[model samples]
Target chain A: MTQRISKYQRLKMMNPILQFFRFIYLSIKILIVVAGGHGGTRNIKSSTSSS
Target chain B: MAKIVVLGAGISGHVAASHLRRKLPKEHQVMVVSPNSNYQWIPSNIWVGIGRMKSKQILFPLAPLYKKKHIGFKQAKAVTFHPEGDVTENKPYVLVEGVVGDSKGKQEKVTYDYLINATGPKLNFEATEGLIPGTNSTYSVCTYTHADHAWEGLSALIADMKKGKKAKILIGTGHAKATCQGAAFEYILNVEQELRRHKVRDMAEVTWISNEYQLGDFGMDGMLLSYGDMTMKSHEMVEMIFEDRDIKWILGAGVQKIENGIAHYENLDGEKKSETYDFAMLIPSFSGHGFKAFDKNNKDITDKLFKGFMIVDANYSPKPYEEWSVQDWPETYQNPSYKNIFAPGIAFAPPHSISKPRKSKNGTEIFPAPPRTGMPSGITAKLVADNIIDTIKSGKEQLHHKGSMGNMGAACIASAGFGMTSGSGVSITTYPIVPDYEKYPKTQGRQLGKTFGEIGLAGHWLKLALHYAFIYKAKMKPFWWLIPE
Candidate 1:
């Protein structure tokens, strides 16, 4: 089943038009991650714990 | 009660100091020593070089910002480092030559419990002749004054071209060992853009001269794009773009001298030739300034340092390029002799050349720096501070830092035009640097994913917004903490 998924992923890159859209999709995904990221990987903490 | 002193006030210094402020105890003293009164985000200097931005917009006075953070600031240039205290006098301090205000060349001593020598590269204009005239010829844009003068020179050249006179502009570093080759590349491209926009590009001829083995090397030992071997092929990309704008290049050449309109260049094969230009902006090479820190024996520590650059906690040795393992590089930027001493940014030396360290026929060793662009350098400073603070608080050997330029992934967007489109910005990201020799034994720093530059409107917005966003963060506004370390 994993082999089939790998094969499907390889097949998707074969089409240039699809690949461009896929890239856009990936970047948009990354853009969301970037937007959501607090700028860096360092964990942020608050002085007064609310929970 | 540990007292720490940080030298310089550029991006790397500010990043280290600002983060150090948050990491250290309120009672623990923190001080910043620098020659400048303001903090300048130097990456935008390309725009400043082309007159797109003013010196005021790019720099902010460091005094007020330091005050708000309860941080002590000194506007002075350090002249010497006495790492080992003189037991005879019973006082230990670094002697500094004050350059700010009426001190205007007064010398003073700054004592510290721990010191960070983040004094960055020196713009050794004296390294090249005729490139900086009276004593030399061409103009420079390495600092506010240099950039200011370059802007004026560029405008004058533009005015001459508008009047139907021929103008030739030469842009590149003045020496073979210069870092920041990317900044020079950015300036030459911006100059080309401005000339074309003014419709005077046809009346002008622009040339680039550098010691880089190839264009776009940016000293990162060659990065890859999604396409493949981008470094080997970027010359074609520059050639295409240059051809489109009627620009030319004198690649793999080092500038020897500049006398008015003539520039003497040594070709890749070491043959010297002269090229004439109406205007030239040449970046200079760097040396460690051989700062003196002392050992218990009072032996001078200058020999351990690189010229103009401060030697940080890094393993220094000549490892073969084929054996260039990431493990050989630094993760935690702590000084080898003193744990409190950390060298971040250009001050810290990479273990070996990013490009295979080379030598001349006479065996003149040339060590090319591993390019640490402004962004990554800032990150390294933050990480170094974080680790130091952790060590201070825990009183145990804290986890060492590991922001290796070789293993780190980096992205750069070289602007073709300052507009709001992807077509306007040429951006590329490379990853898993130290190209997995096991996976791809033949290459170094090759890309696993596609490294492509998309030219569109959005890239321009990202670049401009980044300018404001980074400035906001550096100012340490309320949201600055939200912006990231």
Candidate 2:
């Protein structure tokens, strides 16, 4: 599964236009996460709660 | 209460100080002493140089942010280090001359339990006779002011091109030992893109000149990246790009000197040549920020540094390239002389050239010095901060972390323009920035599988995103710590 994903990623990178769209897609997803206030919270909860 | 003093508020020092303020107790103080009050996100200087972004857009005052984070801020330049207290005092303190604020130009002493020297490169424009900004033949994009000036020069060139006058633009490293070929590469491409945007590309002659043995060396030697079924070296990809873009290049050329629109350089063949240009943007070589250190007895320990870079964990055994080993690289950025002092980022002297050291037939060394840019510099800063925090807690240097460039990966997005749909950029990631021969024996010092590159509008977007994201993080917004280095 990991290799398949890697190969897919590599293929996406080979075409500049495709990669641009992929990045735009990824950027949109990231923007959505940021808007949802979950963009940088993976370890925030654990680290802050412990502190 | 232990007080930590961090000199310079660059990416490395600012990040280290921010982390320390968050992790350490209120009793233990974190103080940052820097000459500049505004933290300039330097990577975006390329955009600023091209006139797509303003200097004000990329700068944020450090005082307010540090105050909000409860970190002490001193706008001052560090003059000297007193590792062992002077005759009047017994505690280690740094002599600083205030550059801003109420105490501007005033001399004062600040004591520290731990010291982090993160004063970044001193732009040695004087190294070349005509490289200085106001009195120079060539311009630079290394700083916000310099970038603004470069944009002004570029605007004039563009104006000439529009008037049907052919413009020659020479862009690359100004010194034989200069690093940051990446910046020059981006600058030249962006200039070309700008020219095309104005329909004046045909009127402008773009040329790249560098000290690298080949194109895309980027000071980590050249990397090998996979492209579809075939693997390609960086030089091959760069050549293709240059050919497609109609850009001319001169590699393995050490820029000897520059005078009024004429740059004299020597190639690897020991052949000297000169190129005249209507405009040029040359990246100057870096040196230490000129700081002297002293022992308790007031004995000068200036030998602790070489060419202004603090010598760290590596064995300083001067050996030729044939005898260079991976162990010569510093695993931990701790200064051997002072356990409490750490020089992360470009402050630390690299062990040796990451690229295979090369020389002309006449024996003139022409290889570029290693570059410690964004990713590797940030990782090293975090590691150094963690180790310092541990040492403070245990009352001894108990924790150690290593983020050597030889075992690290870096991502670079070189922007060609700042447009939503019309712009383009190149994204590249290379593993173990310094090639590790032992781990990947077959790949000639690097892991070929982990290195790759791509170009598109998406790369431009990514670069733009990073510019904002890093500045937001540097300002210590909520959950900023979660942002990867």
Per-residue C-alpha lDDT of model 1 across residues B118-205, encoded as one tens digit per residue:
7877667777775572223377777876887788888888998999999778887777666677778778878887887788988887
Q: Give the range where candidate 2 chain B is weakest over 10 consecutive residues by summed lDDT.
A: B398-407
Error of 2 at B368 (Å): 0.7
Off by over 4 Å in 1: A1-51, B88-92, B133-137, B227-233, B304-308, B357-368, B420-423, B432-443, B450-452
Error of 2 at B220 (Å): 1.0
Best by TM-score: 2
For model 1, what is the alpha-carbon lDDT of residue A2? 14
lDDT of 2 by residue, B126-161 (tens): 776678763444889888988898888888878888
Instruction: Evaluate residue B448 in candidate 2 and report its C-alpha lDDT on the 0 to 100 scale.
Output: 67
In terms of docking quality, model 2 is incorrect
Task: Return the TM-score for candidate 2, rounded to 2 decimals.
Answer: 0.91
User: Which pairs in model 2 have colliding backbones?
Assistant: none
TM-scores for all candidates: the values are 0.84, 0.91
